[model samples]
Target: MENYNVDTVLKDIFDSKDSNNWKPSDKIPLVTKEIETLKNDLKTFLKSSDYNMDAILKESQELCDETNLLVSGMEMCKQEIEEETMAEILHSIENHDRLTKELESVNFALNIVYDVVQCGKYVKEFDDGREAQSFTRAVEAVYDLLQYIEMPAEGFKQLDMYNNTRHTAQLILDSLLSDLYGEWDRLISTSVKPGNKKTTITITLNIEDSLIVIDVLNALEKSKKLVEKVMEFSQFLLKDVLVPIINNDCIVFAETDELMTITVNQKPDFKPAYDAVIANLRLLFHYLSNKLNVEYYRDNSIMKMMGKQICAEFSDILVKDCLIDTIPNNINELQSYGQITSEIEDFQHFLVIVKFFPDDKISILKYVNNIDILFASKSSQYFLETARTIMLKDLSVTMSIGVETIPEGNPGTSADVSGTEEEALKILNKTMPRSLFYFPRCMISKTAQELLDLVYVMMEQAVQCSDVVCKKLYNTTRLVFELYDAVVPYHHENYLQTIPQYVALFHNNCMYLAHNLQTFGDKWLILMEGRELDYPISFVDLVQKLRDLGYRHLAIHMQQQRKQILDNIRSSDLNCIVVKDVLSDNAEAAVRQCLRQLHLLKNVWIGVFPINVFTRLMATLVNMFVDELIHRVCTVEDISMEMATQLTDMYTLVVQKAPLLFQNTTDVEQYVKSWKKLQELIFVLGGSLKDIEKHWKDGTGPLAVHFNTEELRSLIKALFQNTQFRANLLSKIK
Candidate 1:
């Protein structure tokens, strides 16, 4: 409000020397009033007017200039202070270097302590368990040193200041950790000892050594027992537990009406024992998770694999026990199957047992497959044994047999019966009744479905299994499959060497097999439908798997039998014409034998022998019969007309036997070819050439009327077997 001269008042205040001594504090009232005025002016300018920088700069220029001069002066003072502080810091650094050298001298004195850590670097060479022993001294050395890192911040500060000490300490710790890791690697290597035949004694000497090695693994003070826990679980579970239980020689069984049960008490302490190991391992895993930078799953895999192997062994033992108890009883009951034929007392029992097999099989498979899966995942032998058990249950005869003799027991009062054939009577009487039991001549005991099931178990268990297991499975399946042929000889050396019995048994057993296979295939398909049994494609279907299982010959044999049955199975036409006994019959009896031989030749014979071979076989038998008949008739002491007439009747009957033997045109054609061979002999057997012609031309003799001299001669030359007989007959023809 005081309007003094504006420019001159401020210029005087700026230029006056007195202003230097004048404290701004003393002029606070004037400065406060001036600020009040400027603040009011700014408010007015913001409300109404455009900004004018020249006017604003003119007002604050003095204050701004003063602020810049003060800042420059303060900056110069700060630089001078900083220069002196830097010189002092350099002196402190020089002092720190001198102290570090002194500390280095102290560290030189502690070389004895560093020597323990240096022991790890020297332990590069590891001997048997001794290499790990060298690590023990190193571990003990660094055990105290590792705690240095774990010390409080202020405590660790002492080491942090001395770089050489910290570096040397770190190197010692690294060396100890490396040696400890090497020891762990050793433990892991010793955990499994495969290739031992007795897997029950699973621990190798390396594993035993692992015990001592692990005890010495007292490194990394925090995780000292971590190595032992891992090794103990991995090695001991299989060796100390699984092996003892599997290799336990104890056999325990309890029988019931329905089935034989393996005592649960016999199963080893596998789960409880494993669970305990798992509990310790879980803690070990937790501890190792912190100390080591490793995958949780990978670090524990060695133990897990061992655990699975234990499970495999446990399942196998349970299964083996189940089979050992049940199979013997099953076979004992199976032996009673012969009772269905001969012993009728247990007829209902036999029926029930046979009928229950499917259910029994399912039950057996339920456990076996579970066991098989355990091993299929880990071990090969579990699979091999499971596949092997199905047949091992009844390792006796391939055929089913009835008890024929009572050994050293009660009898039907007679010591020996007159006229009873020695062979037949021997079966009737016995010192040991069961021992005399042999397969009934042509009767088959095992159902085809049962045999097929055996094949499935043998092969399916081998699926996804190891190479060694697959080989054993293949060889065993082949061996068991051969039992079918032995029990019921489709083909055997005895059958081949003995032709007459071969023909009879071949037809009977062939039909037995054909009918049974058809039933088996139907049931097997039904059983398998909608069921996804884990099998290789070759084994998925029973029919195909049998072929792949080396039972290809048997499978093909069944197929041929099926074809022959479809062709026709004439059980009534079964020929009992014994070729060996034919020569013993009288002329008329021999004629009847010839007719019987012809009847057999005509009927369709289904067997291991194909139709072509069957036809040839029949032709040979018929030729032999006719040969015996001719020899018997011609060699008679009296060559009278009556005898000649009797020969005509025999020849006629032989020819009559051929009329309806064949059902088809092709078969008839084949029969006629064979018939022509017989006709040659018939001409010679009828009489001399003149009488033969009478018999041939005459309407009376059926064969003679049909076959003339040239035809008969051609038949003998073409198909007749005996050359001397052919010559003798042909000479008579001339």
Candidate 2:
């Protein structure tokens, strides 16, 4: 309960005691009768209304108590004034109490007004239509009340309930939409006349109009509740304007659920239209944000319009998605892969351009397909599948049967009667493409392998070189490069298409070229080296950046070339084992086997290995062959002229095969050492061993020409005991 100053009220009212109405003696009864009337009036007035009756009832009860205080002393006090006049004065106090309750109602009115303003200020848009209209009506009600009783600050000061309420300067901004929109549309000028005739136009906003919006913005910012209200309302207006553009006219198909003709063939030409849209939006939203000071509203509203209204809706409807599905399936068709890849690149490029909004810090690209991830992972996998399919179908690659071996101790199994797999023969077979005739025609296949190459390059950045998926993608790319290179000859000879026998001739020529490359060696290797491409990308260009990574040389088929002579020689080594080398029964066989194997191994390496290594293998084989023949002859029991002739013949045959080995005098001398040693051995047996030994020691005898005294004595003493050697010695001596 509030403390009431009834004494002050009575003192002020009684200050008129000296007025020319009545004596001081008569005033007492007048006050007594008036207080009794005031008490009766309170009981009557309290029954009028129930709203805010707590304060009204409290005031009435307090006034009744005050009446008792003022006139209760009537019997003890004297009367001075008229009873009727004092009763009128007390009745007037009842009216003042009622007026205070009405003032509380006025404060409640201001609270309602501030609330409607807050509704417009708080959010970007009234997403709920019913709520938006309810707030609008509430603001109008406040505006109407503002006409009669301007909200006095004094009414709100006493009330704790209405203390924090803010009456915005933009009191009825919700009411200003029609006129502001008119100004916007007028500035935009809906039907722009390019020439004499007015054209039907869709895009209404322009940079020039942003200036008009600028002035309007300056005025609106002065009333931020109005700016916030406009920021929210502008969205509905923007959607009404922009969403229709996407639904009606779009570069790509955006499904707006409209009954219109949209087909794959009718794909939108988006660049020019998007250029205009972006330019207009950039300027329009920026000016709105600056003028109204609601950047969040401007950016959010436009992003929603672009993404939900335009990009996302259109992406779902694009006919290109169907093409993306088939690209993996049609990897073998070069033209189809090329076309599909070209189209996808264009699509992604367009999205990149569209998503770029200079005015917006956050991209409005949420609705996109995220083609980066798609191309990196899925598209790459699809391309690999395509390449593998091509390799399987066109190249004729398949699993091959390996050599099967039984345990070392197993019997020959010739006695086995049953046909169980344990007794079954381990078979040997080869698997090869039917048309490995494909080799000589080095370049008969072409592929759209560059797409896979691009994918490899892109993914390599995201992964390591050793990563399995990356390695597989790289191999696929490399094979595609191989296929492209294989048929690259036709690329340079486009006019050959008119020639009737061009394909046949070209294939025959490739075969001829490959055969020459295999047989002739370094001339072809040198010619083919660094000839893959003249620029950055070649069929053999290092995709993995590792050496020897891509297409095997067309001459790889040459690995299968005939080696019948060398094979027979190798087979010969398994059949022969010589005793004392050339003197043994199988010495010639061993010598021939060893020399032929060495020749085959050396000649084979000439095409692949460095020249020094080939020379070394040749030298080793020659030296070993000569040494073996000489050693057996020197140790033979019947050392004679015939043995010397045979040993010399073998050395000459070897020199003939490889003339470079004996090109120098010293090398030729080294070559003859075995022949010379045989001759001196036969001479020592023909002559006296004692004299040969003495001459050998002095370096002056027939044996001394080749051997020292110790070697001569050793040879002569060994041969002297064998009867067959002594007989050949006697015959040679005769």
Candidate 3:
């Protein structure tokens, strides 16, 4: 520049360093003028032209070198900064991981504390006493420790404690509810007094184990203040769970009492420990029912209870009435009677009272006056009548009326003979009306005639005997007649109307007679027959004769009747044939009636037959022809000697043809004796059959020759030898 100073040159180079890529150096300005001049020259040169070419060149070279150095330095600095930034990021990441691990540890500890608290609460609800207390204490300690540790992290500490406590409390409350419900159910299931009616309780828990666990976990997770939260949950449950259970149980108990007075008189001493148990059980059931919303009333327990109550009541009543005891006694007595009895005299007396006061008028009146007195007075009547009705029917009674003459202390007016007679008539008339009335004529009207005839014959026979036996017979006959007087007149008034009643009375009398016979032996029959001295012989003869004659006559009559009816149907006019057909159509019924009557007579005879005779003649007759005899005879009057002969012959032939039929060695001797007797019967029946056959063959008999001829021949052959003929005769007879 004008003799450029080295210092200036250096200064210029240094100052320009800022403008170019040159390193700037710290230097002081020399003088004000020089600094001004240098600044002006620098401005002029910068504005006008490129200055300091050689110097600029040298400076540029140096600047280029410096630029290179500066760029290298900047790149190094950038590299260092990038390395530092990466290191800081890595450090922050490490710190975050450490904090995360610590938080996780805290959460894990809180969870453990919450679980312990929940377990404790559950134990408390279970009310396991010492076990529950220990568990609760352990839980509380765990919760306290967890709270202390979590205190520093304000948000986490509060939230964790609350969640743990709340969760534990909820578990305790739920357990309490379940326990209360269970207790209620047990109480209701127990039986109580007043008929010992049992009550049933049902409960349903809807919450599953998994669901309970899940809810408990959720509550614990959300809870913050452990202790307060636990207590709050417990209080909530006590109010929501226990109170409802208790209230519901009480209501159910109260309602049951109002609905039915468990009349436990039958189970007088029955008492259960808990009266409220049933109610509680019912409450539990109600709760379950409501929660489930289903019908469960017909539960097995309920049905069982109902059934037990019904059975117990039935047993008590059945025992108290002594019905079971009376049934066997009545049946045994009936069997002994050997005949059905309708009119038991004692029973008749009871029936008379019952019928007249069927509405219990008299009895009720008496009861109203004094129940105990009525029951005591009439207890016998009730039991006896009940038993008699069970054994008989159509009962009636007659009470003897007596008049007592009384002397008046003084006559108020004239002599009162007419008044006294009228009064007596009124009393008799009023006391005995349609139900309890007695008219002498009406009483003796029907049965009196038959009874009197029998009595007359009996009296005559008794008189003829004229011995001690005869005297006994006479006394018995007199007594029978006296009994007739007592019963006949009252019974005969409505003979057809009261036939059933009469039959019952007859049965009772037969029973009485049978009892007497059993006590006194065949003396009664002998007395009736009037052969007091030779009673045994006479009785046997009479019985045998009756059997023979009765059987024979009945068989013949039946055969004749059947043939007559068939003949009528075949040979009669159309109208007559129609009528006969109608009659024949009902023949089965008629036959059955005949058979029943015969069976009755047979039963009576068999019952009274001597054991010896039964083993001999009667047994044989019964075996061979009892069925035929029953079918043919409607009454004892139909029996005849001819029938007995036929039966005897038939039995003899059968025994001869098939000896095995008489296999019983004990009875074989009897059969032989019976067979001998049958030989005589054969002769008698053969004669009758021959006579009937001859009459029909001569065409002098209404019996068709073809019919009677075949029947007679068959009967003879069957009695004699042929199986075909016997079978044919059996068919006809049967």
Best candidate (score: TM-score): 1
- Ten-residue region with minimum lDDT total, candidate 2: 257-266
Q: After superposition, how far is residue 632 of candidate 1 from its true place, in Å?
A: 18
How many backbone clashes are present in model 3?
29
Tens digit of lDDT per residue, candidate 1, span 673-700? 5455345455555446445444544434
Candidate 3 is scored at a TM of 0.19
Q: Rank the candidates by lDDT, best first.
A: 1, 2, 3
**What are the lDDT scores of the predictions, listed in order?**
0.43, 0.40, 0.38
Worst 10 residues of 1 by lDDT: 569-578
Best by lDDT: 1
**What lDDT is obtained when candidate 3 is compared to the true structure?**
0.38
Candidate 1 residue-wise lDDT at 475: 50
Of 1 and 3, the candidate ahead on lDDT is: 1
Estimate, for each residue in 12-67, the C-alpha lDDT of model 2 and write its tens digit: 65777567676667777767776887777667666664667788789999999998
